[model samples]
Target: MLLVKILKFNSALLTFLLFTSPIQANEFWGLESWMNSLKTPDFTKIKDVNQRKQAFFEYLLPEINKQNEKIVQLRHALKTDNINSFKLQKIYNRYRVKEGDIDTLLMRVDIIPASLILAQGAYESNWGRSRFAKYYHNFFGLWCFEKGCGIVPLKRDKAATHEVAKFSSLDKSVEYYMRSINRNSAYATLRKIRKNKRDKQAHITGLALAEGLENYAEIGYEYVETVQSIIRYNKLSQYDYKS
Candidate 1:
């Protein structure tokens, strides 16, 4: 009976591993290997637009899904019945800076569409081949004024001290990217558009929401247009579905 009990425990452990690994270990090769695979030009040069879009989405979908899981878990922690629990209060305290109040924060916790972020990241990082992405995993061109925030841009204006933000890991960069769009005043229009879409539909498409990013870059409307064009030309809207 002892041998049988040990066998049962091993079976249960295997089941648990299968269930948990997909969510936590989506990178089949490991983080650095996964990052290197995305930087390969072979995936970027796929002639078919949908094929190329799929390649990019495949590289990022696991990371995006993981961040959204954390956001959802935090939002669930604030549920009316759970808000006062010690576990939830800890979560709330951690995210209080990113989310001002629970209600307002829930509105911002939703995921940005894979297609929209993909287009923007591709534009910013040159398909992960940019020097910034190479050195810093700074795919979004996000800036921080803190003295040691990240890499200092060579062409930063003589009077400007903003450093391009660096991330310790690629997923950390993606997490910060989503949070910046969600909470930053500069992307209020995008968040508003996203909130409205969430109210109307169970799932929001990236193409519909790209309009609200009109001010995302120095080029303003032109940048929004370029993102939309990338989405349109690449048929990236197909990847907007979460499941």
Candidate 2:
């Protein structure tokens, strides 16, 4: 009876360990490898617009999906007190900030996918080659005219020095990018559409959001149309949806 009881206890503990192990341990490793593969390249050589768009979507969409799934699983593991699962979940959680920012903004307003934001970062900053991006962490081409705002890149302004906004870290840069769209005057229409969608309990749509960002680029209405084209041709709007 003593031996049988010891055997049963051991079996139960093994079962617990197996069941509590992280669900996506292999997947988490895969994600890290994938992220590391994305070495910044010379954007000038990537002159084909279609190719650039494809590369952007291919690189970004999977990361977003993986992070989103990890966030959900981590919340579940935390609730269940699965210590092993929690440890694995924490690895995935590191990427959740970027994913959560996308999810939260989508919940509030019809906005572009986090992939698009990454693409814009790649495009505007010339794949992290620009002086502002390399030194100041200005990922989104944000300009700052006020004193003590940011570093003034020599090539930024033709007539005089133009300050490029800086951030303490990459995460802060991403946060500022999101806030710039959600709160800035140029994006007022986008904010209103998002507010209207939330009030009505509607899913945020990218095309609708694009209409409001007409002034986002110097080309005004043309820029809006171009963004919509990028969304459609690449089927990027699919990333905007949550399941």
Candidate 3:
């Protein structure tokens, strides 16, 4: 009887391990681990423009989906006024990227790295601490002059000091950000590059997208360089993939 009991205990332990091992493996990899597996492009070594473009788009899609889902959940939590949910959702919404707009942008232009975009949003909004970001859901630091759309900041400047835009909710803010990039003439170069990538069935690269936003910063050309530096130094673009 004692021998039989020992055999039964061993069988149960083996069954438990069998059921739990796969789950453990999946959890071990996680999202960050999967993202790290993507091949990093050595700009110096990769001379083929077409190949580079293709790689950029492929890498960007998964990251875009991840950020978009977070924004969606965050918007839902805010609308419901669930404070606990809001706290959790805030992390995702803090660096939002619109899904539909990204798809449209990619369809019309080349792919942009989702991580780079999110990093820019985080920086612009000061990690969601900026007045516009906290009160208006303006995650991208976009300024609006028109009435009925945004609020005017207390401090006014010649360029955009008084011109802060507001949103009714997080979704609207994300929508506006997408529209700003897609419709604005300044981003036309970006749109065109996207179109070319789509035509050739290629991926988007953060390096390429940086070129289109030559005017994104107050510092002119230097702003573009800064974003690139952030992406490279921190390896931010590596997050633009799935696990």
Candidate 4:
């Protein structure tokens, strides 16, 4: 009788594993498929400036929209339901918020506008023709501190220890970019601007938030102006309407 019980338990466990493993595999394959969708194109070969800009937008906008949709879902989850402590802690860690600081987590997990993402990507990667964008898939100029973690900047300061971060896919780069914008101290002003807009129930335009990005480049306000100029020039605000 004891032997028969043990055999039945083993059989049940085997059956459970057989049933669950394909679902796990399919989840992984689905993620792989999503990553595969964000293919990079050789923007440098496009001779016309207008054509290059259009191509760049077309390449990035879909991935950007997907990322924003994810954030919206996460934000909704946090607002509407009680998530498990482990999952809530993961959100806090991802946004660098203090544990139990639900308010800050909510603030930091919001979506960045697609227009702002496009403008920043266009400027930083030179419409995807930059060496870092081509080789490393690093569009937002993020840095990693560990050695061998990323590509060393050719023009890095002699004492600087940071290297530009590399990504396996453009969508991952966009994910990190949005997270950085949400959590990094340098972009606190931008967050505040976004929060205020949210409070007022106003349209969150890329042009409005660009005002807070004074520290994004060494030129301060000039950088903000340049980003706003790009948004205006390309009619990027049109994308922000749905953001």
Candidate 5:
């Protein structure tokens, strides 16, 4: 297992480096444009669910792999007690993680399946047409309680003061979304669910993962159901093959 993991980490590092290389790096508006430019069709106008899922998943798969690759690298780092790698250490520092906190690091570094991510993005961003999605490129409906950490909802309830998180680009939003779920205590159950699926080599179902995100919205259960509905209606289960 250790040898296999090391080989996988090496390959992943090479691929990650290639993807980030200036020649290969796409210089687009990022996560938003990455999806918006898929098939060069306006994302909002795609009325066919299957076709929509195709365009979206084709774009999302590479990103999910990239995140999981990072997790693999982190796992390798801990297993080998290698903490000084620049890229891995930077990612750890960005997540406010300590070098030796393996469990916390694992939870923070793992991947959320593309199926669940796509389903949540579709629901939260209104098929990429919401104001947060359009203006802020925030596809995840993430909120920031700090005044400057996010944008204030114009019609926000006076009693509620949380602001919707904003991102400079779509990729940043996606990165933060994964980090938020992986690191936040609220999503521990969700992480555990994904971890269990990995351990058992079982296919991850967006419906099951939705159980872990009950705290994602004020409406709670309604939000989970809505996400599950989107996943089922779009056949997103086809994309949850990550193992």
Candidate 6:
């Protein structure tokens, strides 16, 4: 009886591994070279508004997909019992969760839907034409506090210490933006919405998650409404999971 149960457990583990490995492998296959060759296009040079918007989205989609793919891989790793202890510890530290607390790590390590990312990027950066976006690759309007850390806002009060955060590349900006959304207390509601959607097997739409971002801007709920409006007007939902 013991031998039979052991064989069954082994078979189930093998089946699980077989089912998941291919999907994760395909997500990463051939992506590194393509990502390496990518360059940020000069969206500011496009005169037509429609053409510029199209160019901006095109430039951003691949990097967004790449970042989401990495998040998905991390989530998958966390679900397995045999995950490397070193890698798991790194994930816990990176997400600022207690070590061995897989539930919180899972919530913090998940993907931000492409639609939300795109809408926020467009709304914040004026469709990639803002000085921060053009000069610093900071499409999400992230701020940094250390002196000389980033560009100071022209309109910032003399007493204000925060400066708009700069990034070495658009990818870095997206990475930090996603990390902020996942780990920040301000977006705890957003993470809850995402986790609820996952539990229900629902398509995690940007419009739905946008509701949790009322505090993202000083304008409160108005900011959430504007983000949702951007998603609707631009049809950014098409980039998100359909089912």
Model 2, which residues run further than 4 Å from truth? 1-112, 115-119, 126-131, 156-161, 241-243
Steric clashes per prediction: 0, 0, 13, 0, 0, 0
lDDT of each: 0.71, 0.57, 0.54, 0.82, 0.72, 0.83
Per-residue CA lDDT of model 1 for 1-243, tens digit only, reads 985686576557656756676634433223443344344445445778667656666877778778777776666666555565566555455444433366666666667887888888888987665766655666788899988767788888989989998664668789889887876767778877877876777567787778878778888889988999988987777767562
Q: Can you write out model 6's per-residue Cα lDDT over 1-243, one digit (the tens) per residue? A: 985686576557646766766645433322322232234566778999889888988989899999998888777777876588887788788889999788888889888888999999999999988988876788998999998778899999989999999776778889999999999999999999999999999888899999889888999999999999999999999998543
lDDT of 2 by residue, 1-243 (tens): 985686576557545655786647544433333332233233346678767555645544554455445444544554465547455444334333332253433332223445456546655776555755544556578877786567767655577655778664454565567656754667778767766775787866666677877777788888777667656665666677453
Write model 5 residue lDDT over 185-213, tens digit each, in one string: 88888989977886788876777888898
Tell me, by lDDT, which candidate is best.
Answer: 6
lDDT of 1 at 234: 77
Per-candidate TM-score against the hidden true structure: 0.72, 0.52, 0.51, 0.82, 0.72, 0.82
True-structure lDDT of candidate 3: 0.54
Q: RMSD to native for every prediction? A: 9.4, 14.6, 17.0, 10.9, 10.1, 14.4
CA displacement after TM-score superposition, residue 243 of candidate 4 (Å): 5.4
Prediction 6 global C-alpha lDDT: 0.83
Better of 2 and 3 by lDDT: 2
* Per-residue accuracy of model 3 over 1-243 as CA lDDT, tens digit each: 985686576557546765777656434333223222222233234457556444543433454554555544544554465547445444333334343343442332222466557556556764444656555556577876576445676666657534677554454555556546655677777777756655676665666677777767678778677777766765667665322
Local accuracy of candidate 4 as per-residue lDDT tens digits, 51-101: 999999998899988998988888888998658878988888889999988
Q: What RMSD does model 4 have? A: 10.9
Candidate 3 deviant stretches above 4 angstroms: 1-112, 158-162, 241-243
After superposition, the stretches of candidate 1 with alpha carbons farther than 4 Å from their true spots are 1-55, 83-100
